[model samples]
Target: MLYFKHYAGALLLLVMVTGLISCRQEEPPLQKVLEVRNLSDLATTEYHITKIVKASDDKTWYKLGDRKILMSVEAVLKAGIDLSKLQPEDVIIDGKNITLNLPAPKLISLNLPPSGIKVEYQEIGALRDPFDNAARDALLAQAEKQIRRDIAATGIFTETENNTRTLITGFLQHAGYNNITIRFSPQTPLP
Candidate 1:
């Protein structure tokens, strides 16, 4: 009878210990995570320019004094934001609200269509050299420069900002986030 009593006490102690451990909640690890890397290509523009290239220097050298060539060029300009510049402190998750500071938009790529080049007129003097592939390429480079300048002047960055905000906001909403706040890096003024 005494042995049975000791056995019952041991069982009671075991049950109490198990119940205490089970009632205690485990604390989660202390860590801060704001991992987000979503690089997206957002905007594209097609540009066309008609430019006139005058070979005045060649005129002096080869008697091609009144040479004027007309060239037409078409190119594609792609712009987007690069998320690789995101920093750890740039993101904050608070309840249902997520605030993210995205990097500034940039011009991603420029491509001239294969069959979009047009050389309307190439006037060569009798004693001057013909307009070759090198000359055509140089003119096209000029057109490319002008196209890029025009694209910048037309506020491509603004369009990119709008598109990025819309895209990310929709994404976060779909993921069950109630509020989404996105801001771009401020532009630094040049001296």
Candidate 2:
């Protein structure tokens, strides 16, 4: 009786092992729909730019001498497309050949950290008062504005667009797309 019980137990364990071995995990289905919220503001490129801000208080007719301040400011610029702006009609997939009308690349953010701005040189006239915080801030603001205008000259926008295209193209290719054409759609600023 003992010998029969042992052989039955061994047989049961072998059957359980075979059943477990034959079971396979099912893979999740590939997602076809793109979620815009998940792809919002995908910053593809960043640039660190330094600008020299110099301003002279020479416009005053009664001021005795010119008071000049020179400052060095570093600005961080991030650029990318807002994929959340993508519309259903923007993407057209015809049997693995996909065409996407993506949002145009835009300047995502420009940050000038307070620590990155320094007053390098200042020439205060003997009769003139020193540069105050408000004056310094105004100079920095003007510099920031100029930097924003000059960002396009740095080629950051073009590089950001190219990087975004390469990333999306690779993603689509991996999703089984053979041919991909991407076009940038013009976006109007929201008031």
Candidate 3:
């Protein structure tokens, strides 16, 4: 009975030590919130002047000042926003000295055409597996590189690192995902 008690005490002590060690392990900080500038009605619309030439009458008929006035309305919307929500007669734009006529406006939203997550690892010293510090640095570098490439290829409106995060957050928000997290791990080599 005494032996059993000693064994139990040892096991309990081991478990306690393990629990304390695990409690000391710190978790990664949460991703920062990025601010996205809302699109205004004025900056999203424009007008162009085009010359309308008549070939049959051999004359150029201009509607306004020797050019045809063409109005265009463009709204830079977040991904998953319903384009059909905008009506033809909706007051889509109110630019300075330019009231856009939205006879039919085509909506365009910035979205990731194709995005992926990648992981890589770098060895520290002669260690077979990278330690947490090396792993974290590698993961961060990979994420930043992938994010920049994705943004450039997709032509998204990401002016800075914060903007890139904002673009991703906006996409997630539009997709109805309020709480999302991105993670990376060491890449496994194929046999």
How many residue pairs clash in each candidate at the backbone level? 0, 0, 0
Which structure among the candidates has the greatest TM-score? Answer: 2
> lDDT (0-100) at residue 95 of candidate 1?
73
Residue lDDT tens for model 1, 1-191: 99999999999999999999899974421112222353444443323434444433453653645555776666766677776677777777787788889887777777887577777777766755777888778888877776666665657677778887887788778766787899998643211
Ranking by lDDT: 2, 1, 3
Give the clashing residue pairs of candidate 1, or none.
none
Candidate 2, residue 154: Cα displacement in angstroms equals 2.1
The best candidate by lDDT is 2
User: Any runs in candidate 1 off by more than 4 Å, and if so which?
Assistant: 1-65, 188-191
> Candidate 1's error at 184, in angstroms?
0.6
- lDDT values, one for every candidate: 0.67, 0.84, 0.32
Better of 1 and 3 by lDDT: 1
TM-score preference between candidates 2 and 3, better one: 2
Candidate 3 lDDT by residue in tens digits, 75-156: 2233222222323332222221111122122122332221222222222233123234444344445443443344333323
Give the distance in Å from residue 80's predicted Cα in candidate 3 to where it truly belongs: 14
